[model samples]
Target: MTKTNAGRFFEDYAPGQVIHHAVPRTIKMGERALYHALYPARHALYSSDQFAQACGLPFSPLDDMIAFHVVFGKTVPDVSLNAVANLGYAEGRWLVPVWPGDTLRSVSEVIGVKENSNGKTGVVWVRTRGLNQHNEEVLSYVRWVMVRKRDASSAAPETVIPELAKVVDPSDLVLPKGLHFDNYDFTLAGEAHRWDDYDVGEKIDHVDGVTVEEAEHMMATRLWQNTAKVHFDATVRPDGSRLIYGGHVISLARTLSFNGLANAQMVVALNGGAHVNPCTSGMTVRAWSEVLDKAETSVPSVGALRLRLVATTGAPFALRGEDGKYLPEVLLDLDYWALIPR
Candidate 1:
C-alpha cells in the first residue's frame, strides 16, 4: 500500500459525511506580520493594541481575514486538493475574534453534490467551520467546488443541491464581546466616513492597484498552507502558468478597499462571493465597492453595512455584461457585512 496521500475525489464525498481536516495551525504575530507584508492591510483595530483597547477590546485580534485564510487553508487537502475550481460561497459568518496564539482547525460536512453532464467532473458543496482549540467556532461558510472524478465510469451519487441564503441576516451577525465604537477615532481610523456617510448604491473607487508577482503569489499560498496543486503546479493546467489563489485576490481586494473604507473595520458576515475570472500572476488588481444595504445592530455603538466588493483588472464599477455574465476583466465579486462606528 502506498503511504502517499492523493486527496479526496468527487466520488469520495457524500451528504452528511463529516471530515476533520488534518492540520491545525497556531496563528501568531508572525503570521500577521507576513500577512501584512503580503497584502497592504491597515485596519487600526488590528494594527495597534492601544487602538483596540480604546475600542474596548483587551488587545488587537488578528485581522478577520487572517482567521479566514487560516481556516480556509486547513481544509484544502480534504476539500479541494483535487478540485478543478472553487466555484462560489454563501452564508458565511465570523463569530469570534481570533486572538494571537489561538490554534485553529477546520471541520467540513458534505452538504450537496451533483455529477456534471460530461462525467469528467462534479460539484461538491460543503459547510465548513473553523474551530479554535477550545472547540469554539470562529468562522463558518458554505462553499462549493468543482472536482474531477477518479473514474469516468463510476456510478453517480444522489444529487442534492443545498438551499443557501443569498445574504446573511444582519440580526444573526455575531459581534465580538466588549467591542464598541462609542469613542471611535476617525483620525486614527484613516477615513472620516462613518456608517451613515455611505448611502445604499453609493460606489467608491478605491483608486489603487497592485501587480501580483509570481513569487509573491507562491509565497502567499504557502503562507496560508493552501496545498492545492493548481496554485503551485504550472503543469496542472493547459496553460503553463500557476493560478493565483483566490484567497490572495480576496485579501488584496480587501487591502485595496482600505483607501475608501478604512473605517469599515471588522468583517462580521460574508453573504456570498464568486471567483468570476481566473487570476494569474502578473495581473494588476484594482478594487471598488458599492453599498448594497445597511442595518443597525443591537450594539448601540455599531452599525452594519452590506457592501459588494469587486476586484478587477479592467475598470471600476463594471461587473456583469449584457448577457448577465461576469465581464472578462472581473476577478472576484464578494458581498459581506462589515461593522462601523455609528
Candidate 2:
C-alpha cells in the first residue's frame, strides 16, 4: 500500500518556492448528485444537463466550493501538514467556470515567510491557483497559515511579514467570462429573483435541513484527500471522535441557499467563516441567509450581493433571532459574496 503525503512541515518551505500539487481530479455526475442531496442545490446550471445547455453552458458544472475544496486539498500535502492554524484568505477570484468532466490541478507559490517574534512558530503565505485540463486558471487565492517549528533551538529566519488585506474588496471580484443571464430561465433556475429584486437589507431564510452521517463526511473528506487526523481517524483525538471539516458545512449551507437564491451564483468574496460548534455524524444541518450588502459588478450583466450564510445542527428549519443571537441550533456563520443575475 502506498503511504499518504498529507501535509508539509515549516522547515520544508521557503519564500519564492513554487509547489505544483499533484493528483488531478475529474468532477463527475455522481459528485453533482451528492452536492444536490447534500445541500438541496437547485441551480439550473448545476442541476440538469439539459437546463445547463439552455443557459449556454456545455453541461452542468460542479459547485464552486467543490472546485475550491479540490484545489485546496491538494495543497495540504505541500503547505499545511504541520499547520497550527489557517490564518485567512484574500484576493480570491474565480476566473473560469468548472464543468463536470474538467480535470482540475493546483500549483502554489510561496509569497512570503516570516518567523514569529516568539521564535517557536512562523507564518507562511502562499497563492494557490486552480487550473483546468486546458491549463486555464479557474480560481486563485492568497492564504496564510501558522506553522510550528520542529526545532525551537534554531535561530529565527528573516522577519518578512507580508501585508495582507483585511477583507477582499468587493469591487475586485471576477465574474466568470461569458456569464450573463440575459436569457436566464427563471423556471429552471428555480427562483424568481431578478437582479433588481434584492434589497441591501433583504433577509432570506432558506428552509432546508440535512442530517449528516459519519460515512457521508468521511467520504467527502477522503474525496478531497484532506487527511487531517481530526477530520478522520477517531483514534487520534482524545475524545475518540471525528471532527467534521468546516468547509463541508460551508458548502452545505451555500448549496441549500440555492432554493430561493439560485440566481445568486459565483462566490466572489469570502469575508469570513467560522464553525461555531463541533458537528458530528447524525446531526441534522439546517441553513438560512441574510443579504448584508449589495453592489454592482463591472460585468454589466450581473450584480454582486454580499450575504451571511448560516448553518445550524439539530434543526429542521431556517433561523429566526428568537433568543437574541443566532439560536442555540446555529453551528456555523459564514460571510461571502455571490454574483446574481441582472
- Each candidate structure's TM-score, on Cα atoms with residue i matched to residue i, is 0.99, 0.82
Which parts of model 1 are misplaced by more than 4 Å? none
| Inter-residue clash pairs, candidate 2 | 7-81, 8-81
Task: Give all candidates' CA lDDT scores.
Answer: 0.95, 0.76
**Collision count for each candidate, in order:** 0, 2
Q: What is the lDDT of residue 159 in candidate 2?
A: 61
Best by lDDT: 1
Residues 1-342, model 2: lDDT tens digits: 859754666666788889999789998777777756555666666667676676556666677887888888888767876665566666667778887788999999998888787778888989999999999999888878778787776777666566766556777787765566666778767778876888876777677777887887887888888766668667755678887777788788888888668888668667765555677777888787788888887767678888888888644345546655555677787778888877
Stretches of candidate 2 exceeding 4 Å from the true structure: 1-6, 84-87, 112-123, 152-160, 166-171, 274-277, 298-301, 314-331
Q: Of the candidates shown, which would achieve the greatest TM-score relative to the real structure?
A: 1
